[model samples]
Target: MKRELKVTSDGSKTLYMENWDECYHSVHGALNESMHVFIKNGLNEVEADSLHILEFGFGTGLNALLTLSERGGRSIQYTALEKYPLSEEEWNAVAYGRTSEERVAFASIHLADWNAPVEIESGFVLKKVETGFEEVEFEPNSVDLIYYDAFAPSAQPELWTTELFTKCFQTLKPGGFLVTYCAKGQVKRNMKEVGFEVMALPGPPMKREMTKATKPSNV
Candidate 1:
């Protein structure tokens, strides 16, 4: 797969995959999309002193970077799953982390060991798993939140299937939610079938809607 770096609407850079015709982040604004979809709609919505977050696609590590910076002193245990990890050249090509702390955290996120827990910073533990999510058996009812940042359903239809969403629902702790920049009707239906209460919210710059699927606390 050929990758090219392109500047988004917000002047942030994203990788464009020619083979898939998809970008690692939104073309409208990489930073904005990460902030809107994952941070604002996903992380901030949960009120917890500590968080166990599971990310579907580690891609550019932008979502992890933002979460580290915006966690608001909460203890965060972040577990990211990546099938094909990015090269140093690929991960370093993005325009993220303008400040000193952000730059260091961003670098650490990429440099951390896979299949092992690494403390990237105080109160922030990162575990980078080098395998597809389908192959991993996540402990049921354990995750506090999920960053469902997989590629678009068009590119990988299998990923957005009911089976996958059922796994996501099973992994989430009661009241925990999964957020993504995807709002396809079928995707929401799949989530609902697995007992997640789905919400279609306004999307980021280039998108119209995004999905937030939550597991009910009582369930």
Candidate 2:
């Protein structure tokens, strides 16, 4: 797959895969899309004092960086799954952090050891798992939130299947939510069939809607 870097509407860079014809983040605005879909809609909606988040596809590490930047003295345990990890050149091409300290924090996120928990900062801990979704064993009811930032259903239909959503539902704690930029009808139906209460919310720029699914609290 050939990858090209392009600046988004908000002046942030994103990876465009020529083979898949998909952009890693929204072409309208990569940073804005990440902030709205993952942070504002997913993270802010949860009231937990501390969070244990599971992210699907840690692509450019934009969601993780934004989440870390927004931590308000709250403890966060972030577990990101990436089967095809990005190269140093690919990630370094993105410019999310402006200041020296922010840039250092951004670099540390990529440099963190995989398959083990490492404290990136005072309140942020990251565990990068390098494996396919089907191969790993998820501890039941351990996650508080999920960032389902996988490629579009058109590009990777396997990740959006009901079987996987069922597994995601099982991995999440009661009341935990999963957020994604995909709002295809079948995707929502798959989630609902797997015991998630799905909702469609306003999307990022150039997108009409996004999906957020929640596990029932009483389940």
Q: Using lDDT, give the best candidate's number.
A: 1
Top TM-score model: 1
Among all windows of ten consecutive residues in candidate 1, which has the lowest summed lDDT?
A: 89-98
What is the TM-score (0 to 1) of candidate 1? 0.98
Candidate 1, 1-219: lDDT as tens digits: 688999999998999888789999998999999999999999899899998999999999999999999999999999999998889998887847969889888999999999999999999999999998789899999999999999999998989989999999999999999999999999999999989999999999979999999999998
**Residue pairs whose backbone atoms clash in candidate 1:** none
Write candidate 2's Cα lDDT for 1-219 as tens digits. 578999999999999988889999998999999999999998889887898999999988889998888867789999999987878898898866857877888899999988999999988999999998877889999999999999999999999999899899999999998999999999999999999999999999999999999999999
TM-score for all predictions?
0.98, 0.97
RMSD to native, candidate 1 = 0.9
